[model samples]
Target: MSDPIEAAIFEKLAKADPKNVGGKSIEPADVAKELQPEQWQRMLPKVKATALGLMRQGKLTITKKGKVVDPNNFRGVIRLRLPTEAETAAALAALPPVESSDDDFD
Candidate 1:
């Protein structure tokens, strides 16, 4: 149920080898370019936001120098890749606990 751009980003990453296997990660520009070959530059911010959303969902990983970086606080060049098994586990663990509403008890 993802939008076209989000779908494109996932499709691109799904095709790339996981970074744990010596696969070269992709930059936001790469997805942006694929989504809009001519005006790809205009797509950078959207691409980045989508990537961050994916990472937060534990479906993706954002890394710098081969180490995962906090999605909320990152800068400079970064690479995107499908999260490895361990990364997925860690991401799931790092997620904030959800609280149920009191009304749910009714």
Candidate 2:
């Protein structure tokens, strides 16, 4: 598994965040961009694969293999939401206030 890509995959699966509310643990994609230059070059694909593995295990259910699945609805493109105050502000500022939607239940 010396191929950079495979190495990356291992790194991703080996180190992933685990705060998924739906019991689906966070996978490598969550930290894909965060990987160092060398790490990214090699492990990005791996992380993506790990993400898919999570989905395969039913830890997550999204269209894309390595992506954040909707917590409430798993039939669409769902990405992870940040919990930091900075992230909250960013998300809110990025979107117009949703009058009422089930997506915001979290």
Candidate 3:
């Protein structure tokens, strides 16, 4: 199984280039780059947020037992399983529609 934290860190370092991600196309610069100690420290929360966003968007989930759990609980060094179509649909449907804060503007 793949590691989600490594994947996300790869995504960040790779600048989200699809070509540089996955399989033989993987690049050393993609996942090899590491932030400075201080920067890496600051990035922990952002990394968690990104993981959560991916989960909420139904791209990934936490595998517990035989089912996927919400990725909101994904902590450090954990991998997230990709969600199925039905699971993604359910997740999307459960979310409230986006609201416009400027809707009342004249």
Candidate 4:
């Protein structure tokens, strides 16, 4: 399948993570700003979808209040990041996180 959007999201996440410390995480808007400063509104949903795909693949995690969340149904603000290696493989194999129903980025 085509994955240009996913690839771009992953790249931006990687670049953003070095600054992601103390449970702070990256938001889709951050990626959008870095990759599409002038078109963030258009780019955000795609970024969320791509991030969900990554989370399902065991490459990432979606969190709210520092806890892993059901990406498909979470509400309010959330953050995305690589899943900790210490987690069981099963934890990594859960259904993928879904795109947020509301805009969650600043």
Candidate 5:
């Protein structure tokens, strides 16, 4: 990915597992830290957007309070993680195309 924020988010998620994230889902702050440890807050929006892009692509899922939330319009705190194969496909099918070009990822 060309976007450093997206790459950082994926890098952290890629390490998700019992031994990595303690089986816990990742938050935008986590990816922000990877991108700019000294100022993670500034990276929050980009990280969140990247998470949304991944969700739209069937690679990630967004959740709030342990329940899946709509990727396009979720409010409040959110967590990110890889989705099950079926969930991924279903989520991808349910959403309309928010992105135009393949290179237009957030």
Candidate 6:
């Protein structure tokens, strides 16, 4: 199971406009404000952490200066967006090869 905040972050990023169309990207603060309008300031850190988690899972992208940055090493400002098709392919390719089970023969 995943945290609710993480899920919300993914949902928001997924619905955001494509970079090629409108060049839309979401700041962590934007999500924090949307999820917690009253205490948005307090939610910023949590929102950023959740966004990073999603990025690590290959379901999201974190960019700095319009280019993807290492999720493990970035600072200052960042934007969250759904991974481009090329990025998605690269991420999928980088995954460990799956092992087949004997049950598949049944």
- By TM-score, the best candidate is 1
lDDT of 6 at 25: 82
Candidate 6 regions off by >4 Å? 18-23, 92-106
The C-alpha TM-scores of every prediction are 0.80, 0.31, 0.45, 0.67, 0.76, 0.70
What is the lDDT of every predicted structure here? Answer: 0.82, 0.44, 0.52, 0.70, 0.80, 0.76
What's the candidate order when arranged by decreasing lDDT? Answer: 1, 5, 6, 4, 3, 2
Candidate 5 lDDT over residue span 1-106, tens digit each? 7988877776777776645433358888888887889988998988888788888888877889988887768898999877878878897788776766667557
Q: Find the candidate with the highest lDDT and give its number.
A: 1
Per-residue lDDT, model 3, residue 21, is 34
User: Where in model 3 is the C-alpha error above 4 Å?
Assistant: 1-41, 64-67, 71-77, 98-106
Q: What stretches of model 4 exceed 4 Å from their correct place? A: 18-24, 86-88, 95-106
For model 2, residues 19-63, the per-residue Cα lDDT tens digits are: 333323333454565565555547555555544444443433333
Candidate 5 or 3, higher lDDT: 5
lDDT of the structure predicted as candidate 2: 0.44
How many angstroms is residue 78 displaced in model 2 relative to the true structure, after the best TM-score fit? 7.4
Q: List all candidate RMSDs to the true structure.
A: 2.8, 14.6, 7.9, 11.9, 6.6, 3.6
Question: In model 4, where is the ten-residue run with the lowest total lDDT?
Answer: 16-25
Query: Which residue pairs clash within candidate 5?
Result: none
Model 2, poorest ten-residue lDDT window? 75-84
Clashing pairs in 1: none
Tens-digit lDDT track of model 6 for 23-83:
5688888788888999998998898887776676677778899999876688878888887
Which candidate would rank higher by lDDT, 4 or 6?
6
Cα deviation of 94, candidate 3, in Å: 1.3
lDDT by residue for model 3 (1-106), tens = 1755557554553454445432222222223325334456565655556556666776645444445555545333543445567778977987789887866656
User: Which rank order by TM-score, best down to worst?
Assistant: 1, 5, 6, 4, 3, 2
Task: Judging by TM-score, tell me the better candidate of 2 and 6.
Answer: 6
